[model samples]
Target: MLRSDDLQVFVLTAELGSLSAAARQLELSPAVASAALKRLEAQLGCRLLVRSTRSLRLTGEGELYLPHARSALQSLVEGQQLLAGGKATISGTLQLSAPSDFGRNVLLPWLDEFQLQHPLLSLRLLLADRNADLFRQPVDIALRYGQPEDSSLVAVPVAAANRRVLCASPGYLAANGSPRTLADLVHHNCLRFMLAGRVHERWCFLDDRHRELEQLVSGDRVSDDADVVRRWALAGRGVVYKSWLDIAQDVQSGRLVVLLPELLGEPTPLNLICAHRAHLGERVRLLREHLVERCQRLIQLAPFAH
Candidate 1:
């Protein structure tokens, strides 16, 4: 039998052209990855790869064995999925990625509940504001905001009612007074956040006449982390434009107050993105549905949830 690690090391080394890169992707040291490949070749009694400092190329045996190894791996994964499919209890690691704020505030507890329900299942979550490369990264699932840029990925809508909401803490509002109009925001402290690498100073909204409005608002404070921005808002630092799901509890509990009630924020989608549709197990599909259903309920419960 081809050991899973050996098979993976061979496939990844061939695909990535660098033993170090494949090793890092698998969270194994370069020494271990090299040893695994050597073990595989020793067992097969053939040289599969020609390696040098600059490059790694597959030999004739590797060229022939590559497809079969990949196919075999796929088969094993599918068979495991089939065995676990629709079972009352499901088991296996579910690797997921999400935005930092959403992952910490919203998805963390939700995942906890999921974990409790399926004790056999394991979870690996990576939280970052930037989108993960599904092909290179080990993540099997990701939750994100807005349109998925990668055309190759399959995006499932977790919720369509996602709209930005302008909020400020009660103390800040008391000190700075609520803005009565879009023009009024310029005078107020409008907190800014950075996504990826760009600073998001421009905010979009619909005016009372149902016309689109965009403003490049500035503030005394800025942060790369959305959670930091939210915390600042909660601390009465400044007004922030953010998704309703993020500040639902704050809005409901009166920690933050929604401003400019008549103006509607632009729509953004909350999506469940995956690399491809093939071999997606029933567990993944169920989890998608579960998120959508729960998010819908949360939107319903949130006082001013878009």
Candidate 2:
């Protein structure tokens, strides 16, 4: 088998575009780095790098092998981490981001329970309506609604079957009268929220006919805070279209009533998002499994979870 260090030298050299730079990063001398590269190439029976004193570049064979080499290194690192911290002791600060409403209302208690179970684990939670930049932000994972737009991000399902629900407080329906049909929403006060600097006034759902419909709604109140919208709905001020996980307890407690159960709501599948699969360490995987169980239980308990 090829020495892992040699593979590292080659990968780092390809990435940094300098054998000397790769050597500096690995704390190896220039000669040793060069020798490692030669050994790696010799084992593969190909000239991997076109080298000169002025510049270095990968040959076609080197370009093809780089990704595999990187994957091998990453696998090695993951295996080491799994063995070192995967057991009874999980000691690390897990930084996470989540939506303001779900984070505060739902996820907070669950995380508390998780921390209680793993006493050595520390957590830093950021609750905001806006999505966190996994590449730039300090957050290691994010609990987000809907699928990520950026295909590069890894989205592991926490609640894949979760969907939005149109709901209102009993008092609100009693006073304003219930909307019997999709067109009747024009007469109702549909609560709205702002995200990514835009007001989400269009409520999307499937009609009784199973056709996709987008209802442009308006209300007297609007806020960027999602909890405020749910609160407004609870206060009987307006109707809300929100995730079932966030409002399941409210619905179960008779604080809010699901509307238009005949019409299918837009899918808002929740996911634990990360920048790469390598970020799904043992802790993250365990957390995800925990959430999946909790979320599924809540969804099943609700009157109209779908």
Candidate 3:
């Protein structure tokens, strides 16, 4: 029989590319980690790693076995979670990624409340403007706006009705005046943000006849960080096209006013996304439900501009 500890050691070492580093992560000594690896090899009757003083690399056999090892570990974990009644067994670290604006202004407090509910669970949050690569990065889940372009990933809708809204600070509108028509945006300073290394300068809208309209927009300021653009708008620098969920509080509080209330802005539904269906543990399910409720309530509170 293969010991779970030995399997864990092998997987960690393979992933980290350092036996000592894996041991440190597992809170075990280097000797124990080495022994576990040797014992695993003895059971498998093959050397998994080609170790050297300078580096560690997987052999051909190890390369073939690594995916199987990961699958086995995942299965074991899922089995444990299932037997523990899911939510009650949610005890491990839940690594999540989100857009910087939402993560700080919105999710930070929500997660704090969630942690309080599940005292046994731990959380690790990564905040970035770009999409997190679930396969390459250590993130387990992510909260994102707009439909995922990757068909392989599983996306659970948190706010299907959510849409992008054209907005500006009261101060900015006061100084520069408001855009009454889609064409009027070209005359205004439209704050822009970068997505996937490209500046999102094209703004989309729906006409009063429900026809699609596209406008080429530019601004005095641009930022990769969505929150920075929101700040710039708030500072009376330019107009911002943003997710309604991200600026709900600001809009509700009368800080940011919605600009073209008649025309429909582009839909940008929010989703709780993960790389695989198997990764949807009980904690994720509960968190999704919690977020759905919170998001819907806020959406209801915001003035419908689009």
Regions of model 3 farther than 4 Å from truth: 10-18, 25-27, 38-89
Q: Tell me the spans in candidate 2 whose CA falls farther than 4 Å from its real position.
A: 1-88, 302-306
Q: Residue by residue across 1-306, what tens digits does model 2's lDDT show?
A: 799999999977876788999999889999999899889989999998999989988887876676566556656755776778756456556779999999999999999998898887889899998988776455678999998989999999899888889999999999999999877889999899998889988888876677998889998989999999999999999989999999999988999999888888888899999877766776787789889989999889754443
Better of 1 and 2 by lDDT: 2
TM-scores for every predicted model: 0.77, 0.72, 0.86
**Better candidate by TM-score, 2 or 3:** 3
Q: Which stretches of candidate 1 lie over 4 Å from their true place?
A: 1-88, 302-306
CA RMSD (A), model 3: 3.3
Writing each residue's lDDT as its tens digit, candidate 1 over 203-267 gives 99987688999988999998888888999999999999988888877888899998986788877
lDDT of 2 at 155: 93
Alpha-carbon shift of residue 87 in model 2 (angstroms): 1.7
Pairs in clash, predicted candidate 2: none
lDDT of the structure predicted as candidate 3: 0.85
